[model samples]
Target: MRADIVVGLQWGDEGKGKVVDYLASLYNAVVRFNGGPNAGHTVIANNTSFTFHHIPSGALRGTKLFIAPGMLVNPEILNEEILSLKQLVSSFYLKIDSRTSLITPADVVLDKKIEELKGASSIGTTLRGIGPAYSSKALRISPRVVDVLNESFDFSIYKKLYNVEFESELWLKNAKKTLKDYASDVREELLEILSKQGNVLFESAQGTLLDPIYGTYPYVTSSNTTASYAFVSSGIPYKYSGKVIGVLKAYSTRVGKGPMPTEMSEDLAMVIREGGKEYGATTGRARRIGWLDIPALKYATEINGTDEIFITKLDVLSGIKELKVAVSYNIDGKEVENFSPLENIESAKAVYQNLDPIPKLYASDISYIIKNGWRAAPVQMRKYVSFIEESLRTKISYASLGAERGMTVKVE
Candidate 1:
């Protein structure tokens, strides 16, 4: 059968992990297509919270986990994650594609050094060696997972290039121990699953706005994060691509440095930040909070060809007297309804509309929505959802009310 893709429509942290975890049980396999340890997907299942950087979010659901070649594997971090997962779950099926590149200590050092050299212009990366690891792969000098298993694998080039003392022996030993059994070319198995009509769910790391190509230029992540890349990175043919599910937060939040046109005032940001616990799952840095940008959201959905939308963290916006949504941007005195990557987004002025806010949703309100569907939600909440759906010209199939898996309601 075809594989459905779940991707973040806004910035990287759109609660994609929770959505993937919520739907994992219906899939035969869950695949991580791109990114590395820099991407943190936090999933709360059975009251136990799991922050997965390398492993797929579906691990808690016991779905088959596949790390595709487009991913960069930091062996140490991955090993630690798997070990931790073992204590929470009974067992998990995992496979790392042999072609997946390894992130070495040298890469981490280089990442920090490069960001340091940038100084004021720093991209504010998670400092997980994601960029350097991807660069090594592009230069054809990175050691793949298969190379780590080879006894004769040489790391002299990496040491020479990065000018860092890499413990080749220790790194190789750990890599072998961690990946020997799990590393392989998984394309054939994926093909077999598709041939057998097995359902597969492709999980995307980062978000459309963080994609290297379509994103905000040099400020973007090292790899492609859009839904279309799911097929290219997962080694699955585009013909088998199914629904493109785009995940977005009720209000926008971004981590690190970037042009956020609709960024809220510091006072309002602090309120929402505390309410939503707006912090990076990987870096633990306070995220920049902002009002929802409809222009940007529409741009993301169009580029990814998103089939359905999933609005998350709706409860986070509760209790505010009024809510603001950016309906367009005033770029250089011109009102623009559409977002263009070519324009200077940082300087664009957001034109917002203040709408009536939903009163604080009690546990009972969330429970009612969960049991009675989206129509049962508060009038203001429904109005907010309807505005987003109308603005994007797409259906919102799901909306998450809380952090737990059961806190979600299907939109009808």
Candidate 2:
């Protein structure tokens, strides 16, 4: 396997960066496959905190990092992130895929305008213009990075985009700058990094649940954030069968807007938050917390084709007295065994139960769960994790005992 995929399994803040950084040592190149500069990922290592957006989480590891074409490139944010990364260490290197399109500031303005029309209720967008940028690219209106390198690339098209296109018009209206003025080909530079690096880790932004076509509707970002996206964005063919690791938290969380059937009350939410710094790295917003939702995870596991699963934030529940897991949901008074969203499923009644914590607290092996809490899992927390393994037929290989790197256990 040449392509290893890494993705978040929860709403957005499931601590994928920590695992990516920890396991990056096993890979050669790390690629940021999808999503734009909207999400924030934090990596904690050597007692320092590193926050990254456009760049893959692996960038913090001082490894070869590629910003793939799947991402909506915002030059300002990308440039700022590169500079910030450079300041973290002396030898940090980052590359931008020339095929990736740049998101002009005009995109942001248009995005805000459209959302404004939605009135009193909005999807809590970052207003970074990611959605608009993707829409433009799909609609063939956005100025792609490859276009800049084309000698035949129409300068008039650029003019039309800025002076005429919605994003361009909005940019000209909002910012002192526009997208047309900043298009460039960083391909040659990015290819050089690929030549020097052999092990590439494709890092996906957002969870599969947030994928445009697959994720929760209207609340999803404008791209596919699965391992498949990594292959498409990096221009790497269906060649290598590398290990794809899906990073999930022991529980669930989401910020902004969406249906969270298993959402916990403010008290239980705060309990988990204090342990893992539940605030988003990108928005600095407190994420909505919930019990581990099996129906949701089983779907994510399948979409990502996750070969191995890594469970994070396991230690956060030490204070919960008891752990609750949501096994299934009751939608419209009917048993919805599958994870598919029910139409008019404004809310789902979570079928939950609690489980006792492992007395060992932190064990290097997952056997401890079987020894102490295995039986308790069914009656208490619902067999969410077990159901995930059975449903996806993939075993979880790692369990995060704590937030720090040393706390992860490689489960066989």
Candidate 3:
């Protein structure tokens, strides 16, 4: 089998890791295609919880895990994540694509410096320097693994250049640390994995809307988080053309700052927060909660060339007075449909259309959006699934009724 992609359809924190973990067992390898330590994916099983940052959710698969070249490697956090995976799960092999870029101490320093200077106006960065790293890459001034690979390369020259350019860019103004020795070859390892024709699974860290190019400007994450990132990072052409799986939350939630058209009130937020545990995996921050924005979901599905969609967390919306799905937006007081990379500024903001919520609560502790108890859990669960099928025009292939792997339902 070829590459199968899994990404969050919402802004972020869309339970992509859990779904990836569940599907990992089916694939021979799971590859993390993009992002740095800024993403956190939580997977719960047997009353034990394991969260991962900068590691593929498929690392839980105990297969060959390859960190593709598209990723920005942070050794410190990668080490912790690997150790955590070892403790949480049984066995897995992780290899980095030598072509992958490195996120040095300078990057983090740069990130914090930007936030420190920008203060409140900062675009809710994780201080991981992802945006700056990507920007440097675009400007053709990035530091790559190849740079560190050349034994005879002038590191002194590299340092002077990086320092001068980095300073000129104002990325790491207050930088106190400097990288001494960086020697890691992800190319050799990736080639070895590829030679085996081993099944490669590409895992994406951020959601679709968070991509720097497509997401809200200055607020989006670095790099294109879409499934295509896997192709670019893995050096495998058409890897995802036939095997992409877009992961969508039954409802939507975004963490930190940004314009969220469907954001809920604090009280309503409490309901979803309690029901869904919508918190960031890396930052431990509370996520912005809202109902499914069909237009937004459709945009991601189309752009990613998503072959299929996986709607998760159906158990949480068992019963509420009424539920809302953002069918389209009212931009500039005009009704329009379709998910374009919005630049209308005022018009780009989403306008949501409301759908009635079901009054029966299927999961009381999971979210407050549902008021009805899950008395007839199975039958009620089916009803919720049908609603999604019609709204998103995608099947509810997976349903997470409870937290454990076994508690999930398979609709297909």
Candidate 4:
């Protein structure tokens, strides 16, 4: 009953991997509750950078990892990740829930075809067949991991997948071979750990703004990406959910297509993007950069019930002279306090308030700033952190100064 949750507060790629990896030593188990191979969590520890697509970030720490039933698992991607991680962490053992949806090769092809049909309106998915696989699950035509291992299971169910004409025999054979040893009824395992009062971490893939139910419409991931879904994802009771930590970037970045209110100018964006290494770990696509949007952050906090915030990539703002925070939106000449829906969001204009200049801070400088009040720190940096604390009413627990494990500074 000691489960904690870590969620991305901004768009996806809020550095949840580094946070989870850093915190893995405190937990006995780390479970990826949602999303699929499309989600990439890059962890840097012991001088090696490992990109995790289907495995939990805790895998490198020898923390027991579990892929929950809510995830759409690509057996091929999971197999590759398992093999790659084993090369680094020899004791890596990942459990897959028997009820996890199977993402077959046919699903990958169908995902591309659907995106192609969308043309200019594509949702900008990772094209890893996530949406299509979820769609198959909803239609009850998708096979689960248990079915994949069952000798008598019928493969014809998935033939009715979205009316697509395809053969899945080869895909099934590959999946069966790849995931033969990983499949298990992980619910019992998780329950056993919980019964032992084990500290468990539920790591969610995507951010609150990318959730299907709460995020911007038609531009979101196909599953619930909030902390509230942790129980449903892990088959645990809601009361066990303890800490809901929200990981946010100092600035904002989005991949693919979406209405971004605080997007910076292309020239300014490139400065931050390169500074922060803002590129998709999975697709290598450059993320769209923007100033921190307080309105969006406020909305995320409300939905996820964030207890504390972990700010990442603070070093990226080093060279920028003046920082901007999107306090509110001017939509159709009317100022709004809350985040708008996709229709209104498309036309929303960001209203920014400038702060003092934040100089290029050294690690020692940040450590100083975190311990002492921002009084002697850079004027703008002090105002920036203060604004976040006052606005969200949440403490900034950790600040990631750089990409490495030791680069994180704890706020006292």
Give the winner by TM-score. 1
Deviation (Å) of 23 in candidate 1: 0.8
Model 2: residues >4 Å from true position, as ranges? Answer: 146-197, 358-392
**What tens-digit string does per-residue lDDT give for candidate 1 at 329-411?**
99989999988778978899999998889999999988988998888888999899999999999999999999998999998
- Compared with the true structure, all predictions reach lDDT values of 0.91, 0.70, 0.67, 0.86
Estimate candidate 4's RMSD in Å.
2.2
- Between candidates 2 and 3, the one scoring higher on lDDT is 2
The TM-score, computed over Cα atoms with residue i paired to residue i, of candidate 3 is 0.83
Off by over 4 Å in 4: 160-167, 362-380
Q: lDDT by residue for model 2 over 1-412, one digit each (tens)?
A: 3567888766767778888888887776777778888878788777877788877777656676667777887766766776677777887556565567767766787778878988766777778888888887887767565554453233356445545344443432322232333333333444454466555677788888787777788787788877787766766666664777988888888888878888888987897788668887877788888888888887887777778888787666654666777877888888775676535445678887666653324343334554454343322223444554665578877766666666666654
TM-score for each prediction?
0.99, 0.83, 0.83, 0.95
* lDDT of each residue in 264-318, candidate 4, tens digit only: 8999999888888999999999999999999999999989999999888877897
Runs with alpha carbons beyond 4 Å of true place in candidate 1: none
Identify the leading candidate in terms of lDDT. Answer: 1
Choose 1 or 2, whichever is better by TM-score.
Answer: 1
lDDT computed for candidate 2: 0.70
**Candidate 3 lowest-lDDT run of ten:** 171-180
> What stretches of model 3 exceed 4 Å from their correct place?
138-198, 343-356, 359-383
